[model samples]
Target: MTNRVEYLRSPTAIRERCNELFELAQADQLPYFRVDLTQLDAVADYVIAVIREHYPDLDVPFHSRWRHFEVGNIPRVRQLEQAIESRSKIEQAKAKFDLVIPSVLLDAGAGDCWKYHEATTQKTWARSEGLAIASFDAFCQGAFSKHPYQADATALKQITPEQIGAFFQVGSENPLVGLEGRSALLQKLGQTIEQSPDLFGDVPRPGNLVNYLIGHADQGQLSAVVVLNAVLIGLGEIWSGRLSIEGVNLGDVWKHSSLSGDQLIPFHKLSQWLTYSLLEPLQDLGLKIIDLDQMTGLPEYRNGGLCLDLGLLQLKDPKLAEIPHAADSELIVEWRALTVCLLDRIAATIRKKLGLTPESLPLVKVLQGGTWTAGRKIAAALRPGGTPPIQISSDGTVF
Candidate 1:
């Protein structure tokens, strides 16, 4: 059971198990979604156009949370670097982790109604951009620390839903979805950090993870999977009411009826997203991030919606789009697994069309210059407000 739990947490398991579903999808054995290989060319064409539009030179960064921070052509990240200019590179890296960890945790989908008015930019932003800017502002104001630029366990433990609501500008007029769940997740983060002193440090800050990774690095280099393992081991307990094996909480993992025996499938979506977000900070410290392709494409709404919107995936019942699905529902799980599988196919086709290798255009870069933006573009054209084709009931944790 312990080994099984550990296996479920791995990228290897994600790809292997999801591929099993993909094969089932190919055989038309799955109950909910149908695989349409005929539409894959069209999907790749659309993604290539988006990549050319966004990056004419084809130089794309990883599809991390940092991109959202740069919304509206602003150099918010550069501004952050300037603010901490006096700090050493390691400290700066820590500060970036401090800011990004919480920001990513709070990054589950903000419903269509919520919008944030940024006082600094005097700009009204919605969706992921709005959430990113709001969290950025809160971090700058020291909402999670006594000091203005760090996230300490002490401060995070005391964070309340009202405080989170206030920092996010949530009110009767402006309601951020899953406000309480967001707050509870942060508080749990604090508790997790406090308990794992070996990972966090004596003072207990999320930034302290910088030291842990640095210690774990093999001569100034680290594998992305190691970083993901640390993230899952250190913070897996923060997820609420999740499946557990041998008392180990399986964060972002779910069940699918198509599987044999255990019938369990792991997406680890937010955890992998957090891992992707953490890499830049490590890179800033001059550590080479090896095996970047080992990280799977995130199975969130944007990537998943792309498959549905492009007809690469067709729901057996179109009415599934008309209602909200729980994050753990079998249909949603199948949809996410297929998204992960199809994204690989899409990435391979995209590379062939662009005359590039996986090394030149890794899945992460494909996500950035490629599929995610394409998904949003198609969604906006098909639906009002650019909403995903499938509606998910969020708790400010899972997407």
Candidate 2:
């Protein structure tokens, strides 16, 4: 049996740990991605560059299409669509995610506000939007949606305190703000917008607010994880079909596979576990999470069920460019795919060290035990929304 300290010592050992996770994912046929800790700083630097060039603000407003009862005539959506169309699958995915991440954050603020945009039906379906505000105060007793900014009790010309209170209420009969909280929140949301003129112009529009929200940055690792993960979940659900997460059944799938143990250790569990690890941080921040697993898991295959599984990724030709961006080449996609496989390898080893069986250690539990938690914590420090979860920072990209 390997001692815990020994496993925690060397990078080579950690790499081996990653290899194990990949093997496990291969066994379960799960879509896993490897996150390079060595390159994490580099990737973070890239992220920081983009964010600084774009967001550069500590406070950001959360907005989305859900707030817009009607779609305004703006090329913002088209700009995003065009940017993504010219990029690779991974980059395209990221772009699409960036396009609407603010919407996701606002949705989170509205207590998981989601509405099915039916292109087929030409009609959208939405849960009552103000539910978050109403319910939050009730849940935490004026903490979640606390009525802190009291302007007035009743006034016709000026915005009333009663009027401001209604927007976020979960439910209100003789509500204070009534349906006006949306506008008030939208007005308060302008603070984030005005901060970034390039990202979000000074206009009563949706897309710019959306862009500004995306560019906004949350605090540290844990917060980043929460915000990013939630955004990923939201985007996946909106863009892709309903996110079909492979839950406990993944263990059954992993047990029947033939991947080597070396490749399976550390990576498998880590890949799966990293998904929802931000929950603790969100709860710690006094945010009430109505549903822990609202978003489903990803489907980007690494080893188990993709061409890359047959050692195709290892066969790819390597090319170097002075400035590497996802829009540049297949390098990003191939690297991302390789990452998925590698992540699985890491999970398997960690599971063994923890003396956890595959059945006892489902995919969700892995997410709960991983770096996503740390990501959420980091994000909390970056900005309020306690984990950034979906709020866009001027960082300007879907990280």
What would the per-residue lDDT of candidate 1 be over residues 194-292, giving only the tens digit for each residue? 989999999999999999999989988899999999999999999999999978999988889899768889989989888999999999888998888
**Candidate 2: worst 10 consecutive residues by lDDT?**
247-256
List TM-scores for all candidates, in order.
0.98, 0.25
Number of the predicted model whose TM-score against the real structure is largest: 1
lDDT for each residue of candidate 2 in 1-399, tens digit (9 for 90 to 100): 234322322223334443454444444433323232343333323323332333344121112232232233324334444634655443333333222222222332222233333332354434322332232222222221122211111111233334334423324433221234333333333333344455434432223322333344343213323443322322222211111223211110111122344222222122222223323323333434332222222222211112222222332222332233331123333333345443343344444554655445433333323322333344445445432222221111112
Q: What's the lDDT for residue 240 in model 1?
A: 90
Candidate 1, run of 10 with poorest lDDT: 255-264
The true-versus-predicted C-alpha distance at residue 3 of model 2, in Å, is 48
> What lDDT does the true structure give each of the candidates?
0.92, 0.30
